[model samples]
Target chain A: MKIVVCAKYVPDATGDRKFNADNTVDRVGVDGVLSELDEYAVEEALQIRDATDGEVVVVTVGPEVARAAVLKSLQMGADSGVHVLDEAIHGSDSAATSLILARAVERQRPDLVLCGMASTDGGMSVVPAMLAERLGLPQVTFASEVVVEDTTVRIRRDGDAATEVIEATTPLILSVTDQCNEPRYPSFKGIMAAKKKPVETLTLGDLGIAADQVGLDAAWTRVDGFTERLPKSAGTVVTDDNGSGADQLVSFLVSQKFV
Target chain B: MSEILVLVDHADGSVRKTTAELLTFARRLGTPSAVFIGAGIESARDALRQYGAERVYVVDSPDVGDYLVAPKAEALAQLVQRTGPAAVLLPSNAEGKEIAGRLAIKTASGLITDAVDVTPADGGVAATQSVFAGSYTVNSAVTHGTPIVTIKPNSTTPEAVEGSAVEERVDVTISELAKTARVVERKPREATGRPELTEAAIVVSGGRGTGGNFEPVEQFADTLGAAVGASRAAVDSGWYPHAYQIGQTGKTVSPQLYVATGISGAIQHRAGMQTSKTIVAINKDEEAPIFELVDFGVVGDLHTVLPAATAQVQARKG
Candidate 1:
């Protein structure tokens, strides 16, 4: 069996992340690494591959810098990496991104495709299902636990009200939640092995995707305007003395009608 | 008037608060129509009516309820084709977003998730999204097909308006691909008896300062009938479950009131709850960053502070 894990290189959440003038996130120079959430997907893929004696391939669609994301996954035990890098792919929305990824995954002909619940940067959580739709495959998303047996892939999805055990056949898309498993860090040996791993790069032309079909111009959604969040102002503070802190809090709650 | 389709999120037969919230918001764009894909439409119809649902489209099929989200997405996509609504609104939960994404692709529509607000604009709808962990707010509009939106809970108040929600049984064909993912079993969560964290009007959360003791936090939350949350630090340390985590990677909540105890207020934690209407924090460290966003701050140990606050609230209720 073959497993393909979709990964993204997102700006470090701790960094002062900024957007370019065109409203796209500036991903050029700022510190970036594989999206923390996608690590779970990579980990799940590796686990499934290990159990089934399968090959694990990591796929990403971004600028040249996004190779870091694929490299990180490769270091974490993937067999190889594919990076779809093209200038025309910049500012692609979820739909276009899924289209590109679907084409890339089709090239791999994987038995299973894995993705994170959502990218740390986009936080939209839409691409996995969209990718499944574009591929005409079943999707079991937000899986807290995934297990494979023969031709079936089963997952435990924990919702606010209940937990559901859902399963699908092979050649399906699955997006794992952060609670799925603890992602493994790259060992020194794994890092050294990743240096020799093959990394393939593809462009829109290579994927048979038209230049006009992607990029900001063809995106279904566009950022009309944006505003930087204002710095929060200081609030009233009360130091506990004579046990009056609770009284003050209760009074404030009453005033706010929270009581 | 063009109708706005709102997916009703519920459990068994009971409707969730987020459905009412979506209905309330849908009324702003067009006439509100509810799409109930699972069983128990009879029980959910009253709440849907109260929330101004002009019509309730019911698809009470085991093919939808006994499976994952794909069938529901297919059903909604079919409904969209049949009705040609202005927009479709769903709760921005895990399942809702998955269904919305598939529906978007199936209908060749533009999908927006985790929208803080949606209003009529340019004959479509404009959605305001809080992105980059709430460091920026972006206004967006769909340029392609119909706009499919998934809104966060507590983005607006659920206003009850009297409307006769006439039920319409809609027949939908569940695609073979959708039926491949079948739900084998469902295990009901052990009821905390407390309200759900996202839908609760008041939320009392504990952080690393609790030192693995959620007793005081639970006591305070119970006293006020609020839900309980935990900081990522606390959750990472195995002090609480990840489901209870409130942070950038965890569930984002915008309750009417949010109280943080013993939390240092890291940006990740703030990213989840900063949109809360009113915030109050208590910590021994007076300089904790959590105080910056709080409307009221108390400098004291959570062990000493939360108990006292709980007593005060209980006594007031008595």
Candidate 2:
């Protein structure tokens, strides 16, 4: 079994975010790490690789700096990495991004493709579904647990109020939810071995995909202007006057029509 | 004189509010035509007509509805090829985003997801995206095939324009290749009697300070007909479902009013709900980060604050 795991390098969600003069994100100073959710995708791919005896290939599309993300995944026990780097690939929306990824997956021809439910930076959980559509494959988005047995994969999807079991055949795509599994940490040995692992670099042309087909120029949408969030006026902070705290709270609640 | 294809996001042919909103946005760029991908087209026709869809392209194929997004994309791709619409408008939900992505590639068109607004520009739809956590607004136009845009819910108020929408049955054959994966079974969510989160006018979310006690938070949410959300900490602590997490790592939601209880607003959490029109926070700590972005703040124990508020709302209704 062959598995392709799509990963992204995004700003550490916990890092301080700064905006550039143009109002785009100042990603340079921020720590660019593997997306937290993508880790689970990588981990889930490894789990499947372990269970099925196959190679786990990590793929990402970004600038030259994106090599670090692929390397990190390699460090975390992936067998290999593929980086699709092109300046023209900059600012591709979910649709364009999925196109690039689908081309990469087409090049690899994997039996299964896995992705995190959404990227931490964009939080647009649209890629997998789009990829599934582009690849013309079955996709189970937001899968909590996926167990591959024989030729079919049994998945548990966490719905609003219930858990659902869905079954899909092989050569499928899954956008794994965080509930899938606790991702494994990169062990010291794995990290060191990753340095020696081969990470293949491919340009958009190398994948037989035209860069002109994606990127900011071909992107369907754009951002016009952005404003910082409006500062909220502080709400009333009615402190307790000894035992009268509850009464004051009730009065305040009544005033707000809450309760 | 190209038409705009609006994908009707509905359940059992009951059009969703976002559908109306999409039609409202679609009409801005081109003539509005609805693409209903479901089993019940006859039941959906009246509402589709009411929302200014000049034509209803009905694909009442169970094969399209039985599976997930792939087949729907195939069906929409066919519609796009047939109508040569000026643009395609889909609700910016998870499924809609996927459909937009697939349809974009199939038609070799430019696709944009999470557009806050859409307008007519340069003989095409100009879409704006709130990017970089709403720090930058990007105005973009698809230069490739027909522009495919998915607008987020609540991005605009839907104004209905009653039209003589003629229903047309679009003959679509789902490609066997499209059904590469099938939904062997579907488990609809146990009805959470509350309103949908994105469409809800009010939302109440709990943060780490809740310490696993969501009783007051749920009660307050129930009182105001708001959807309940949790911060990553609360969800990580097993206090709530991960789906209810509102953060950079969770579902992004923008409502008219957002109430945070027992939450110290982390930037990641704020990324999810910062676009809300009004924000109120109740925290015991006066300096909790959640208060920084709130329109209203109450420095009190949420346990004390929320129940009182809930009771008041209940009494007001009584």
Candidate 3:
């Protein structure tokens, strides 16, 4: 069995994030690391590989900085990595991104594909389903727990009002929620070993995708403008000197029509 | 005016609040129509009619309930082909987003998720999204096909405007690929008797300041009939379950009233609740960041302040 995990390199949430003139996020000079959510996908892939004695391949689509995302996955027990890098891929929307990812996954021809529920930067949880649609594979998404048994994968999805048991056969796509499992840190030995692993690089031409089909110009949706949030101004503050804080709060709630 | 298809989110026959909100918003751009996917259209019809649904497209097929989001997407896509609606509205939950994404691909449409607001623009729809953990607001419009939008819960208030909810059955064929993911069983969650966190009007949340005890938070939430939420600090400390977390990684809630108890608001935590209409913070430390966005701030111990507030609310109601 071969399990492919899709990962992304996103700007650190704590770093100063800015947008460029093109209304795209400026990820060039900022601190970039593997998206915190994708770690769960990698961990799930490693667990499945350990159980089935399969090979785990980490795939990513981004600039040169995104190679680190695949490298991190390799250090965490993945066998190999595939990085799809190109200049024209910048500012591609989720649909275009899924197109490139589906092409990459076709080259691997894996039995199972996994992804995080959403990316930290875009926060759009639509790529996995779009990829599944493009690849013509069944998707079991937002899985909190996953169990594989004899060419079948079952997952527990916790919804707002109920918990559902969803199952799909092998050669399917699944996106795991953050509740799946705790990700492991890379060890010194594992980091050293990852340096010797093979990391394959591909371009849009290699994947048979035209440059006109992606990039900001080809995006179906474009950001017309963006505004930074204003600093929150302080509201009314009261000290409970005479044990009247609760009363004051009630009065304020009444004034604001919150009660 | 062209029709705006609102995907109804419901359980059995009861309509969810998001559907009503979607229908209310849909009336702003075009004529509002609802697409009810499973059985129980009769149970949901009154709410649909009350919220200005001109028609309800019913598809009572076992394939929709038995499979995952694929069949539902297919059904919606088929309706889009038949009705030629200007836009499709769905709630921005996990299932809704997936169905929207698949429907976009199937219909060659532009998809937008987590939109806080949608309005008519240049013969199409323009959407506003809170991105980068609510630090940036982006306005976007689709340049391609019809817009398939997934709106966030609590983005709009539901307003009743009576209309006819005449049911029309939609015909669709579920593809072989969509039938691969089958739902085996469904177990209802243990009822907390409180409103859902995302849809609740009031949310009372605790953080690390609770020191691993949520009893006060639960008590306060129960007294006010509000949903109980926790900051990431509390959830990471094992004081609360992850499902109850409200932060960048957890659920985003835009409730009418949000009460913060013992939480020193981090940006991630604030990202989830800053959009709430009214906020109140109670913490012992006067310098907590949670006080910055609150409409009212109480500098007192949460253990003391929350119980007092709960008692006051309960007494006033009685």
Q: Which ten residues in a row have the lowest lDDT in candidate 2 chain A?
A: A237-246
Greater lDDT among 2 and 3 belongs to 3
- Please compute the TM-score of chain B alone for each predicted structure, in the order given: 0.96, 0.95, 0.95
Q: Which digits, one per residue and each the tens of the lDDT, describe model 2 over residues B7-59?
A: 99887776778888998887777789999987877778888888899998888
DockQ ranking from best candidate downward: 1, 3, 2
Q: Model 3, stretches more than 4 Å misplaced?
A: A238-244
- The interface RMSD values of the models, given in order, are 1.4, 3.4, 1.6
User: What is the TM-score (0 to 1) of chain A in model 1?
Assistant: 0.97
Native interface contacts kept by each candidate, as a fraction:
0.83, 0.57, 0.79
Model 2 C-alpha lDDT per residue in residues A173-239, reported as the tens digit of each score: 9888888888888899999999999888888888777868777666765544455543556555555
Docking class of 3: medium
| DockQ-derived CAPRI band for the predicted complex in model 2 | medium
User: Candidate 2, chain A: TM-score?
Assistant: 0.92
Q: How accurate is candidate 2 locally (lDDT)?
A: 0.79
**iRMSD computed for candidate 3:** 1.6
Q: Please give the C-alpha DockQ score of model 3.
A: 0.73
DockQ of each: 0.76, 0.50, 0.73
lDDT string for model 3 (B1-318, tens) is 989999999998789999989998899999999999999987888999999999999999999999989999999999999899999999998889999999888888889999999999987999999887778899998877889999999999899999798889987898888899999999877878889899999999999889998898999898877999999899888898777889877899999899998999887798688888788999889999888888889998887777787788788778
